[model samples]
Target chain A: MNSRKSVEWRKKAGIRAEQGDAAKGDKLQSLGRLEPLEQLESLEPREPLERLEQLESRESLQSVGTLALNVNEQPILVVDGLTLESSSGQKLVEGMSFTLRRGESIGLVGESGSGKSLTLRAVLGLLPRGVQLAAGAVQHTVSSAMVFQDPRGALDPLCPVVKQVAEVVRYRQKKGRREARAEALKLLGLLGLPESLAREDRYPNQLSGGQCQRIVIAIALACRPDILLCDEPTTALDVTMQRQIIDLIATLQQELGFAMIFVTHNLAIAAEMCSRLIVMKQGRVVEEGLALDVLTQPNDPYTQMLIEAVLPLPERAETDAGAEVEKEANERSGAEGQRIAHAEESMPNTVKKSRMEDLKEDSESQAEGGSKS
Target chain B: MSAELQMEQVKVRYGGFTALNHVTLHVPARTTLGLVGESGSGKSTLARAVAGLLVPDEGRMSLGGRPLEKRRSREQRKQIQMIFQNPDASLNPRHSVRRILSEALRFHNMTRGRVQTEQRCLELLERVRLSADSLDKYPHEFSGGQRQRIAIARALSVEPELLIADEPTSALDVSVQRSVLELFREIREELNLTVLFISHDLGVIHAVSDTVAVMRQGELLELAPKEAFFAQPQTNYGRELLAAVPKMPTASGLVR
Candidate 1:
């Protein structure tokens, strides 16, 4: 397929083509047109296509018992009917079930209070004081590692960023400090970050939100565990940075070949990342399926409602009347380099027109009605 | 003042850092105005300042066309009620819904009689779509959406003229979020209350607001009708925010 050639070529080209430099980027863009691989080198990496491939490679269930369990296969982690109850007897989550196979990625998705995080916490034996794992069985292949939402929240303010990552490497792998620090740099590079950040002895406060998240990912990867659990890893990041982190995780999953359980509220993100998606509501699996089918054609009404509420703004409709006004403002504020860096592409025609006409009509509408306070 | 609530050149500062800078917004009698911004943008600061929770560094504020005193009187404080985003966090954990509402009524000296107050509490809960049975229940028993409705009922218990909500549905999921938003709409119309709704979600802003004010970095970027703001945003930041919204493709690879 055309995709195969382009993906192979881009894989060879690597970082040189990933950056938007015209020459290598042009070659990469052409590669994107060939097949599934061609999409990988497009202006933005083809995440959904890559994710779909990963989804298909997941293990089929041998037995359709209440919880997913296969006798012959290695169970990296097994959790059955996990339930958490608060002090007030409020059922945070109940009757949740799932199992992870070796080198598999399973995504846990639900609104807040659906017990997605609690499920992960129960497996790790880390439930909060008021909460208890009232029911369930948690068995795992090996010790697990976790990456939290806020890097600073989990990291010690007194310690340096590299030191925090090194501590994990030293403790879990029993490596020397010097050896751990050296390994940390390699992990940072593998995650596609500059080597300089890995060397910096600065604290998490000094780094940007995206950079801090990278450091958190670095520490999680340092342990070299059989299973990795991430809780809303990209919730705190901007859109562009969010894409970078998701790509990093996907790449590492392929290379390290570790079982993973990703928990997040964003279905769009879940659609583009996970191998198999497990939908939860009031503590039960409402739906479970291949990522694409779950997002595009949800069987459950709750899941469908969740998808519809996303409010996809027209990419290019120009329906937004404020576009021209914003454009003028942007032109004034964003001198050459600034505006070019953040230019909007992938906008649809409907949105483009809607945004343009929205502004044009605003002036006429203002004239019809007197000025508002 | 031209309306029931008016804020001019309001500035809220913590120590040396400015949280709100020269913010001027007016809420006409019984009108709903949506305040939209991301985290650290100071929309919540403005809401708190209006509710008298935080004194502004520089600004004149008035309620009911009367300039507010340097320190609000007990009667004056009751007129502006603030409904917090997280109902579970805001409500007293030990108090039943009945005690929660009655305490507000008694504290404000608005209670007529015990039987009447109990009846009023039931009415308020019913107004927010809760049944009379909900009065005996604790706040922890309800869902995130239901708890939010209870919070709204408590806010209404005071019978305040202005309502300030900071990211009310941000923590709830979509299905619950939509229902909560509809509840707000119903209360706004039925009560003829003036509302100042603050949130970071543009989708929620579009769903609830008539007029929208876009704020960035503690400054107002654009203020316009909801349709106009969505159609043609007037500021660079505003456009960037609009563009940042993710596209929902109807079919995989085929642009909807």
Candidate 2:
């Protein structure tokens, strides 16, 4: 607390910095980047409609209105005052009420062990051992299927993907193997997977995680279910793959008109993908509203915490890392704002250039570090 | 066999498939180094190699700055501890929390008698933010977050200086993950333990790591000061990785 002690603490921090403590150094370094994150503080949160504008503006040919094709028909699966309990008589989910209309999407966001997954499993009548739907009418128009997070673990390793997909058609539609096989290829293609995978008599081991997940989606769609349950399906995937899978699911919902109950802990993914959102905490729904509204103006403190945790590094941070060594050298501008503006103007191409430069720099650094050691 | 561990040009191979190629890493006394990479990037392999579970074909490994024995001795093996990806699988099904945590302490000769072992275990449990009542319960009785705390307790029971955690919180929900990461942070500071945190999640790596080494396809891509890695990513892989993160539009008046 004294002046000498404060000076000692500062000296210790400097020594730690010299000793290569990145947490200390990064705290000292982030002063500049915090400028932008702070700039965010002054800017008003844009309406979801405005966010939608960016997406829509990017794709004029994409049918936005058609996305709501089967939005408000009827409750495809209505849970009327649902209450679930474990065999030990402990209540899990209570008084849960929701209507998932055909082609509409609903996200169930919650913390771990909050009974979000159990609520979805109750609809599928696939509750884990000793857990049952005590009181609920989980009405469904047609068959319902689940897409899980771990594609590698979800699918049977011994069977080919086509066989797995075809099995669903056979079980649900009573189709013959030959007919199901033909349909399986079509479904896989529809799910944005290659038809060549159908020809490969190889097992799940032959496929990548992304391809395996696509196969899982194909199987989920094989039954042509009016409602589909996706249980943290994209949680295990990388960001780019997660984006592609989300887009794929959205496309499938538009084309097939299957209602989706997307259960996940990721509020950002839920915000980007779902139209309606239900925020859950400790087995109770804390908030429920349109996804955009809830994400933008969340009433619940838990929901706010969830939203704040989904931090994303800005685009400029990624592209401005001197990865584009050539750009840094060749395009010399005096002012910081001008450089950033010019970079923004050539943003698309700059990203590619930066990436290439970064790769080169990484390899060079590895080589240098290796030799030095 | 020494109490420390080192990797010199460690290259892992499965027949012709190379999981790690010429990767050199060092863990000095009482210092944590965080290893990060995408899937299939050999972080797990690196962990396994250090744990003596996997032998690198073309590299030398040493403990306490001395060359490792042709085979790890029991004492040498017990000095290194690993916390795996999933707590669900790592803990035994039949054991109670007390039995599980105490067993590690007894196995490593850290405690002598049952009462002493229980005392040590309880202290560890308390340090990890678990109640004394939890000692009598089974692993399945605890939440995923609690189970991870127990896992950390078990890892610390042996008094190992170096801790290698492979995606410890990847299975957990985000809020639970924050709590568990906080636990790791506390343990690192309290024990001055050297930690090799292996994860695919950049957010997690950034939150806890002092230095981060990025790996790709059995190769060490970039190792930088955590600030340098994030502030000015020098590799294309790192750039694309940063770009792949979905940006939350800055409140243009609200973070809402």
Candidate 3:
């Protein structure tokens, strides 16, 4: 029975590939121009890891690190010297390099316009309009999936949530409609979505932000992807929802053992979720190291600034009394107001002081105001 | 202390859905009150009611001891201003910063003549920490944080007694968010502006607010002084919300 199912799956896969080619043909005809997408589409679908394993075996005898190398372990994706350029030939991302090993997670950390998201998009062959992969090669060793910051943007507004998930399962898993529906429901259940929400007819608009994100994750998992690329998946969520989604992603990563590349501007999140962190600024990596070392003792000034910008939790109360004393000292000199003015001057371009520190300064200046009055 | 803005059991409903159910809140004169909740908890609804965009189904609201009308008069509208989560949505893309601020200045008859209006606009920009050179630029020319500053400047142009900032910093990056929050603090201190700050982020609420109110499912759960709320929340929902906040990972027993 298993052999018969395998035969049926292969036949379905072949038919699906042919249909994909036909669809690509229609796209090419409509565009009236042959693009590089044709080259990507023409490549035959093969198990990515199998090719890597064959390459490893071929080079085993000549390899110098054979004694120390773990034969069973291999990187799921290797991005080498990746370069992205705009239509005007301005380099957006230059010489980007990274690797994702099976079951490992890496975080790409940067400010806005830092090309972190662009690099992630480059790996999925989904560069934005006018942005092209000017150089570099991405050796994707397995199927991958992406979870976007806003789940609503990624989902179809008119389609039912369950139908969307089941559609991915049907196409990627080569399952029948009924089987795909069952699998989709199971995946939604695993993601902790409610029965009412996981219903077959509920549109994306009907669900809450958190529920929509869960559906998006369910769809991504339905493909059984070997690599999960999350581009600020939790950024749009509330604090509680963000924590839930983060934990859910971590748990799913553990259960499925998929390599993950999470992109975020948050240092605390990068520290908590990723084992390795890559700090990016202006389309180039400034620092890359273990998450613990990079967060605790960052080498780059930009990385340090990013770390300092994180709002420290308000769990400690001992600092309040110390701040009170400092306020008194500053008030006595009548320079408290001047200090604040000085702080404001340097606020825009550089990393300003944290909120708590500013609060202390506010109280000091208020003390000066009271004394003057 | 006199309350600058007061809500007495305000109830807002949307076709059988209670967006806000008999919620009462008050912002003391010249102080900041942070209202925090999950999405759909009616925080935005309360903000709308205060801004005269939404009329409550039940209960009364007052501004400076005067009963607020369902549709505020032009004079009453000038006493309160609102800043939204997305500055891009609130700002007009086609208008320059000078045009936006001058329009607000002229609407309230706050200034006469182009010279006086330009001076007042420059003052507004200075208050929000933007330079005068920014006057000629459009909304798209500024970054997210800068556009928000422009929005604040426009809001302050009318010199409102109460400012309603609903998740003003949520769309901004963390580094930029701190500077904006500091600007809010500075404005409150300088102008003595009574602010009703709404956000889903507790850390931001803790940092900027003198008082904090927690709401859930259209119901107000807890309201207390900032320190008191953080020290020991009175409700299970409040406790759960606080616990759910993702904490900054500290280094080897160091809290900072």
lDDT of each: 0.71, 0.72, 0.79
lDDT of 1 at B190: 76
- What digit string (tens of lDDT, one per residue) describes model 1 on residues B75-118? 67877888897888999989999999899998887878899899
Model 3 Cα lDDT, one tens digit per residue, A1-373: 8755654654453233222234443432332211123432343332224433553577422211111123367776889999999999998999999887765678899988899999988877777899999999888656667888899987877668887777777766656899878878878888988876544469999898998999888877765555778899988888778879988987676445567888999887776677789999999999998776787778999998888777655573445554664576778667866777656644552447888877776677667666977
DockQ of 1: 0.17
Per-candidate clashes, comma-separated:
40, 11, 0
lDDT of 2 by residue, B1-256 (tens): 2244578898899899999999987666665567866667888998998888878888898867657655977666766788887899999978999899988777678898888988998899899999999989999998888898899899888877678898998888788888888889988888877788887777778788878788889998888877778887778777666655544433331121
Question: What range of 10 consecutive residues in model 3 chain A has the weakest lDDT sum?
Answer: A60-69
Q: Which candidate has the highest lDDT of all? A: 3
- Residue-by-residue lDDT tens digits, candidate 1, A277-301: 8988877889997666777789999
Candidate 2 residue lDDT tens string, A44-107: 3212233334545664322121234333456667887788888998889988989876556788
Question: How would the candidate models be sorted by TM-score, starting from the highest?
Answer: 3, 2, 1
Task: Point out where model 1 deviates above 4 Å.
Answer: A1-105, A112-115, A118-144, A149-153, A157-160, A178-214, A225-227, A234-260, A309-316, A319-373, B1-4, B252-256
Model 2 chain A — which ten-residue stretch has the worst lDDT?
A: A28-37
For model 3, which pairs clash? none
